[model samples]
Target: MAIKNVVVAGGSGALGTPIVNELVKSGFNVTVLSREGSTTTQPAGTTVKHVDYKSVDSLKAAIAGQDAVVSVLGSFAIPEQIPLAQAAFAPGSTIKRFIPSEFGVNTRKTPGSAIGKILGAKTQLVDFLTEEANKNPNFKWTGISNGHFFDWGLSRGLFGLDREKRTAKIYDSGNERFQASNLPFVAKAVSAVLQKADTPDDKTANQYFEIASFTPTQNEVLAAAEELTGGDKWTVNRVSSAEVQKVAEDKLSKGDYSVFVDLLSVWQYADGAGHAPNLADPALGNNILGLGHQDVKESVAAWLKE
Candidate 1:
């Protein structure tokens, strides 16, 4: 069946706005499902549907008649899986596709790591979605794993880099390259997926699709920053994997996300060395998604301007 209308839960968020705009540009009648009382404005031609994440009835109403659903919805409070499953399996729905908010790290592979431990709840969401898809053939789900949001991380200090000082904290020797994607790349890939919904050759029912822009090392990032800023005036601080792991352990003992930090620490050291073979889907590489290789130097220059 051809996908015509699509819905996005949490469509008012930072990532959701771009996804909504891209979907609308691709000719899908887009519906933005915001939580009730959300103050964010919807884009033109996109309908705003108020749905409470806690209320299954409200979610079902907003999700009705959509060909597919995309969720960028997240919370440090609510377990997202329940609402996501409810929205996917909304009453009298023919919703064929679902894209979960699995946009960071290859969760399926890093099972025993700090991130895996900290994100145990999110992992359960994946398991639930898989089980749901298996039980109901009418529904399908895709988890897009884009390693880390490169530009977003850089801008937001997520990589422990100070944008003003042009300084970053590194793990190990900081020479290992790791995969990363920009927020725009993630939005484009998601939009491309929804636009090409009928063409299932590049998609699976309940599987993960990994995408990346550049796999640059921390040193390479520093070099790129220096080049972009017109000088080598940046600071680089190094931390060992063991130190990171110990910190993560201490944090986890205190019931925090130190585990996730540790996992990220391990990721810095391991790169893609310990990842699964099919983690990056070449079939969905550059063709269906229009995903092109990004220039890190140019991107950094632009970011510095912003």
Candidate 2:
């Protein structure tokens, strides 16, 4: 069934807003369910229904005629998705696709590893969705595991380069390739997936799709920053990928959960020379979902204020 009349939970959030906008732009009938006291306005022309998120019946009422429910809820509200999922695939519900908030690193890749344990909540949700999809013949779940948010990372210095600080942290030659997606690319990718729901040759019923805007090295990103900020104006800090874990582990021993990000960075920047878990090619999903590609410098430009 081609997905239409879609429902987006947490449609007012950072990632959620863009996904909602793109779905509406792609001509999908978009409905954003706001909480009872939400004062934020959704995108123009979107149908906003304020409902009880705690009650499954209220969720069912809002999701009654929808074809898909894309949950972009933040970390704190993840548990609420159980009720949303229950309402989506209920015995006679119209929803055929349920997409969990999986826009970060591949959580399904490592459940036994440290980062996997830290992200257990997210992976568990996917597991639940999978079981539900198996139980219901008409229902299926889709997961998009894009590595990182490229533009956001650049702007916020998550990839180890602070634009305002005029410094770049170079990790082990700084040329290890990691795939990532920007807000726009991720949004359009979701829209495309929903639009192509269960088509003959482009079936997206129960597939977990991996995608990225571009797979660029840190060196490429640094080059873009250096170019945008004049001839290598930024100070560079050289660091060994091998030493990253010790520092992360030390922090983890202190009960700092923020170390999870450090551990994830270890895999993305250091493990197998940056190719950890060694999964198959992501091009298959990108091709199927029509994500195409973009230049990394373009993304760097936005963050560098160039």
**Reference-based TM-score of each model:** 0.89, 0.92
TM-score of 1: 0.89
| Model 1 steric clash total | 1
lDDT of each: 0.73, 0.81
lDDT of 1: 0.73
| Candidate 1 residue lDDT tens string, 86-143 | 7777657778888877777767876776666766766778888888888887878888
Off by over 4 Å in 1: 200-202, 258-265, 269-290
**lDDT for position 239 in model 1:** 79
Cα lDDT tens digits for candidate 2, 54-163: 88999999999889999988777877888888899887799978888888888778687767767788888899988887887788888887788877676666888887
